[model samples]
Target: MAKLYTQESPKQKNLQPKKESIDFILNYSKALSVINCKDKKFELLLN
Candidate 1:
């Protein structure tokens, strides 16, 4: 079981996120928050 576990570890290492994807996700989250704030303000104005 120890030998099998050692072999599987390398596959897990490959699953790490690439820099570009990480950047994209962060930017996307920021953009989403901005949009949500605008939407809330618009709602308030309407009411």
Candidate 2:
């Protein structure tokens, strides 16, 4: 009888993001909020 040889499947990667990535996103949103506030103020001045 002949034996069959099969390759093993690869491992799956982590689905969740790391702490650094979460922190970066949070900081980015905060910065965008500041920019949005400035824009609102500028629009109010022009109006």
Candidate 3:
């Protein structure tokens, strides 16, 4: 099993999310990328 993050270096330990929380962050990042792409296309159409 993977060890928890507290023992990791100070820089790395800044992110201490649980597995589920990390998964949620990943999903949100992907969704944001898609949304940004769509917004770019809309801007191009407006221009």
Candidate 4:
């Protein structure tokens, strides 16, 4: 009689982002709001 063997693979891991990355996203959103307001003001002046 012969015995059969099976091979197994290791599981993958998920990495978490750092705090600085989250802060950068928040600051970027604030900058975009300022740019949008400036664009709107410029358009009003042109009219």
Candidate 5:
């Protein structure tokens, strides 16, 4: 496969977020896990 990522906008590049906000970081990770679990359940239903 050819290298897939093409380019990022300058704004997108500069918008790197801090990893040190303890509460915000934890909530963000929990949200991702919930979304992933929902997606997996959805795929199981489709089968």
Candidate 6:
């Protein structure tokens, strides 16, 4: 079991960066959605 765990540890570590990128993409989409909402509101005010 110890040997298995040692081998898997590097795989788990490699996944950390992928997780971070996913989180960043999620946050970026959220920001874009908020910006779109604000733009719509501004357009309504202009009209």
Pick the TM-score winner: 2
Judged by TM-score relative to the true structure, which candidate is superior, 2 or 3?
A: 2
Residue 13 of model 5, lDDT score: 48
Tell me the deviation in Å of residue 36 in model 5.
Answer: 7.6
lDDT values of the candidates?
0.56, 0.62, 0.58, 0.59, 0.55, 0.52
- TM for candidate 1 is 0.39
**Runs with alpha carbons beyond 4 Å of true place in candidate 6:** 1-17, 34-47
Worst 10 residues of 1 by lDDT: 38-47
- Model 2 TM-score is 0.41
Among residues 3 or more apart in sequence or in different chains, the pairs in candidate 3 whose N, CA or C atoms overlap within 3 Å are none
lDDT of 5 by residue, 1-47 (tens): 78869676557546656777776767765555322564473222210
**For residue 19, what is the lDDT in candidate 6?**
77
Candidate 5's C-alpha runs over 4 A off are 1-20, 34-47
Count of backbone clashes for each model? 0, 0, 0, 0, 0, 0
TM-score, model 5 to reference: 0.27
> Residues 1-47, candidate 6, lDDT per residue (tens digit)?
45553444434544445778998777776555322564473222211
Off by over 4 Å in 3: 1-15, 34-47
Q: Write the per-residue lDDT of candidate 2 for residues 1-47, one digit (tens) a residue.
A: 89768787777776788899999888776555322564473222211
Winner by lDDT between candidate 6 and candidate 4: 4
User: Which candidate tops lDDT?
Assistant: 2
> How well is each residue in 1-47 modelled by candidate 3, as lDDT tens digits?
99786765557647666999989777766555322564473222211
Off by over 4 Å in 2: 1-8, 34-47
After superposition, the stretches of candidate 4 with alpha carbons farther than 4 Å from their true spots are 1-14, 34-47
> Candidate 1 vs candidate 4: which has greater TM-score?
1
Among all windows of 10 consecutive residues in model 3, the one with the lowest summed lDDT is: 38-47
